[model samples]
Target: MTSIFYLHGGPGMSVAVERTRYPQAQEVHWWQQPPATSCAPHPYLDLLEAALVEFRRSVKERGAPMTVMASSFGAHLATHLAQHAPESVERVVLLAPTYNPEQSALRLARRALALHAGHADADKVTAALAAYDAAPGRARFWEVFGALQLLPDVPALYFGPQAGDAPRHFVEVLQQPGGFDGVSAVAISDDFAATFRTPGRSAFNGPVSVLFGRHDPMIDAEHDGPIWRAIFPQASLRMVDSGHFPLLETSLEACLA
Candidate 1:
């Protein structure tokens, strides 16, 4: 098995859920975004790149190129890493990656807002969005909105398929103090939304495996799947019978298939 850097999802959650739940027997370093350290600050692209530099160096010293396994927002960072440092990435497994920044941001806003619509918290959501719109800087808005998606999405996509204690886990983490630092990572990339370079065959020739969930509304496979397929010549995408979190709902072997 190749050495893997497991990056967790979230415009919210910091813990790399896949690190523990994946059950993959590989040498892995769980890399958290917006690291607890002070070196990582706003304009998170620089912060993340620095961390990747260290990861790249560590992997090279050991032997092979690093295989990056990232989900949700983490997948966006992986895409950037592959583009900026093609040589450092040996193989990549993108699990329901929100590759397109503009489209992803819009979709996240719509879906997350819809999650609260016609419900008791609909007014709260409306007010929050309105407040964010009024703010001069919306970075903190993303931090809060990022975590909002997990509330409804995770129960079915993650906990339902894998863990019996998902409800408790989700609640406990939401209640945790200072767990939202990683949400800024999503906001940090907003300014560069227009500049995301889609990887072409010439850019990266690595074997890329994309695992998607056909039923994921947050990331529609029909709309985004072709974009990814066209980007990487050797990239193969397998659609699982799950939601956004396919690995959580389906077997790891199934995702690889």
Candidate 2:
């Protein structure tokens, strides 16, 4: 039986949805390493290394090909792994990948990084956001730094009906000690640009697939879709009728298909 690994999005989220969604697969593995709140330099790299180690172990146990289903931030790590270790990964499914960080929405996140580096008070920022959340007449404070600090409220903004549970779980993880460290934030910002602009030459000779939602706010489908198609000429391009979290909608089945 082939080994299938599911990598969840965000630096803080767990693999609960991946497990529940793809329960029938044999030897399903979820990548869970250092919590997102940890102050690691490169959380993605850390998680990627951990996931690779687990991938190796699973490969040995199952003694077959491997497939990866990665979403959001996890997709970035999965693509990196696929490019560097093609021998282990046969197919890759990327759901709502933020391949390009230069998007307008990401500007707020970049600003948040600047704020953190400039010694901004974390408590003050969090309190202000909490106040905004409580107020009905206030404008939505959707700044990236604020979002990073208060990730628990992100689901409410994006997922609406599905936001409450996932956002709470995300907040719990984000609030953990050492979570959202400076180094990791910087690395994510840099890597996001590098992934799409110059995906460094690697011997990752394998089939690649990119899936995005039609209404994805993080990525500009009109611009990014063509870029990805051009980069991976043999790759498949898919647009689903949903928002950024296509996996949370019906398009995921098409992705797996």
Candidate 3:
């Protein structure tokens, strides 16, 4: 059987494994990039690609080739992996992938602000954003992140059973001292952002599957959907009714389908 790998977002974190498991691929393995610091200067591209290449090698005789479901930042890495090692990847599934950084950040920031409009602690988010504007550092970014969490952006209509517990996931990660800082450290590097800003190679012309939430604050569906379709002609786009985190927002059946 072909092995399926699920790559989570947050650069520093992994997807909620328990929530993403579905009947289509009941036992999909999860992959996370190495510490940005560990692979200093190179980001996690080489390491991730090497691992996936190994995965593809393992199941060569299997009925299917290895498939990757990469989310957000992982999507960027997955795209690069396929570009570099086309033979190693069977098909790429971009789940809320961050194909464009500048646009995605604007969309996410706007969603957080809208969710907190006129609500309690709204001032806090405003204050945090203001702080980020002034200092513009990782410390301030986390402050903004904590502030945004106060808003209930994940709608109950589409958010699955794990909706309520979503915030805790990031909170726990933040509580760990210097844990994810490396991710932020490398992420904000001028060199790193530029790589994604201008993908050196042409669009990935390969078998691909793209899924983005209709309510996703991180992806610009109107703009990105067409871009993705143009890049991967064989890709089938599925617009889900969820936010940035689909596993927490959509049902397994909906996700696997």
Candidate 4:
């Protein structure tokens, strides 16, 4: 049987619920991206290095390439891994992968701006986006973008077409220490994007499946679908009926199918 590896999002988002979906898959529980709160930087390189080590070990144990299933930032990491060590990855399943943090944030901000147009928080969204634009460095960008989670209207943007009823397990994970902050910390790292090599699209021609939620505005499928398709030439895009957390909102069978 092919080894399966699961990578969760949030630079530090809890995988308690996500892990359940891939119970048998190998997971990289990043020590650098811990759940506890801290001021220290959780650089992307740190997590990437650790994950690479874990991935290599999994490959060695199975004596073959492994299938990678990742979500959000985890999906981003998986893509990077495919580029960095494509030989170890046989296939990839990306769930709402965030290719560019700045672009993703901008998309979400624009959506939030529209959603809260008449609401009291409309100005807040605009101001946040403005702050992000004026920010001098990646660190400031993450700082500004991360603060969006605090807005009363921002949470609703992640849900799908159904009522915005988030899973209880997911809600608790976000509330965890460092859960949200780790995201900014990792993205703020100077080497977040610059350190990685940008390989050509032909680098990894493995089978790829990209899943997106129909109502997911945070990483809108409409904007990113084409990008992912171009990046992974063999990628097959699917628009599911759930939100950002597809496994939590929709059945795993449907998502995997």
Candidate 5:
């Protein structure tokens, strides 16, 4: 039996949502990165590297070859893990991954920073994030943030109307004091861009699978689908009926099969 590690998206999400999807796995490990702290650096890749170190330690302790199932931003980290530590991972599954930060929600976030910060001052970006964190309802922020991150017409995928509740829960459990600042730094950093290009095709020595919703608004099938296919020639590509977060709507058993 293979041990599976599930990675959640964003800088603030908990492992709870992902854990529920794979109840039957032999063992399920959820990757929890450091919380968003105002004092912490904003660049996400740095945080992601720290998470990878933890993941390697966890994998060693489990004594089982790992299978990684990651969604959205989590997928980005998973890709890096597979690239750098291929021997520890047996298989990879990426759900609605947005590898090209320039095309997805990160771009919107950059634009938002430009609008609010005037000239990309790190302090201003941090302040704006802090304000969003201090907002009364955390879930509302998640929903708004999700909408900004995902494509417009695909609210059902990332957040159904009920998603408001999710963000609230997320805020309660995952919101650290400096989380917003950390995420902002990561979103705007050039290091992430450089990492994306370098990991091109040699990242994984095992089979890789990618699942995406046909209606996914944030990631265009026409663009990303072909790129993935080309990159992972040995990979399997599945298109589901749902949007960005397909695991929320589709069964993990079916997806794994």
Candidate 6:
């Protein structure tokens, strides 16, 4: 039997909400990247690939490939892993994967501003963008990205209203000590953002499933969907009515389907 692994986004975000979606009868390995502090310099890609390679080797069937389901930043890492160690991954599921970090951030910023129009905290979005404009550093870029996408008033931006308690669970996960900051560190890593700017395609020829939220404020599906389809010709792309957290926003069965 092929093992299933879940890689949560945020680099430091909790898997609490993600874990709840799996059926009790199924065994799925939840792989959480250590807080960005521990794996500095080459936060997501390098560190995660190495660990996954080792884990695949140590598994019951030595080096047996597994199915990898990853979201957001984790999806970014998963794509690289499938390419670097194609032997270790049998299947790939990407949920709202970030194709180009820079583009995605810009989209989020614009969406945030548009969504917050006339709202009192609208100034906050402007301020965040201003910070990035003044010093277009990776760190500031993420601050602006967060300001736009992770705004306290916009739970619907990620988990739509249909997701009962999911938005609250996500907030609780971020509230964990060092959670939000840790993700920031990964986003700000010197090379992390650059790597995803234009990751053309993956060499992994296995089955690939790409899920995008229609309401996602991150990447523009209409634009990136074709890019992803080109990346994996055999990929099955589905756009669902939800936000960034498709796993949490929709039923597990629907998401998997």
Q: How many clashing pairs per prediction, in order? A: 0, 5, 1, 0, 10, 0
Consecutive 10-residue window with the lowest summed lDDT within model 3: 153-162
Candidate 6 lDDT by residue in tens digits, 1-257:
55777777755466665665554626467655555545356665565665566456545454477887888867766777777777777788899988776767667677768866777777877888888888887778767756665454554466555667777877775677644665544544546655545556788998999999887888788888898887788899988888888888776566567
Q: Is candidate 2 or candidate 4 better by TM-score?
A: 4
lDDT tens per residue, model 4, 6-32: 787765466665655446544333223
lDDT of each: 0.63, 0.58, 0.61, 0.68, 0.62, 0.70
Q: TM-score for every candidate vs. truth?
A: 0.71, 0.64, 0.69, 0.78, 0.66, 0.81
lDDT of each residue in 67-96, candidate 5, tens digit only: 888887787778778878888888988888
Q: What clash pairs does model 6 have?
A: none
Q: Write the per-residue lDDT of candidate 3 for residues 131-235, one digit (tens) a residue.
A: 888877556666776677677743332233445665555445445664355454445433345444445443445568788877666777777877776656677
Scored by TM-score, the top model is 6
**Segments in model 3 whose C-alpha atoms lie over 4 Å from true places:** 15-26, 44-64, 118-191, 200-206, 251-253
Order of the predicted models by lDDT, top scorer first: 6, 4, 1, 5, 3, 2
Between candidates 3 and 5, the lDDT winner: 5
The alpha-carbon lDDT assigned to residue 97 of candidate 1 equals 78
Give the better candidate number (1 or 5) by lDDT: 1
lDDT of 1 at 118: 61
Best by lDDT: 6
Q: Model 1 reaches what TM-score against the true structure?
A: 0.71
* lDDT tens per residue, model 2, 87-165: 8887777777766543434433334434464444545555544555576221333343444554333333333243235
lDDT of 1: 0.63
Q: What local lDDT score does residue 138 receive in model 1, on the 0 to 100 scale?
A: 47
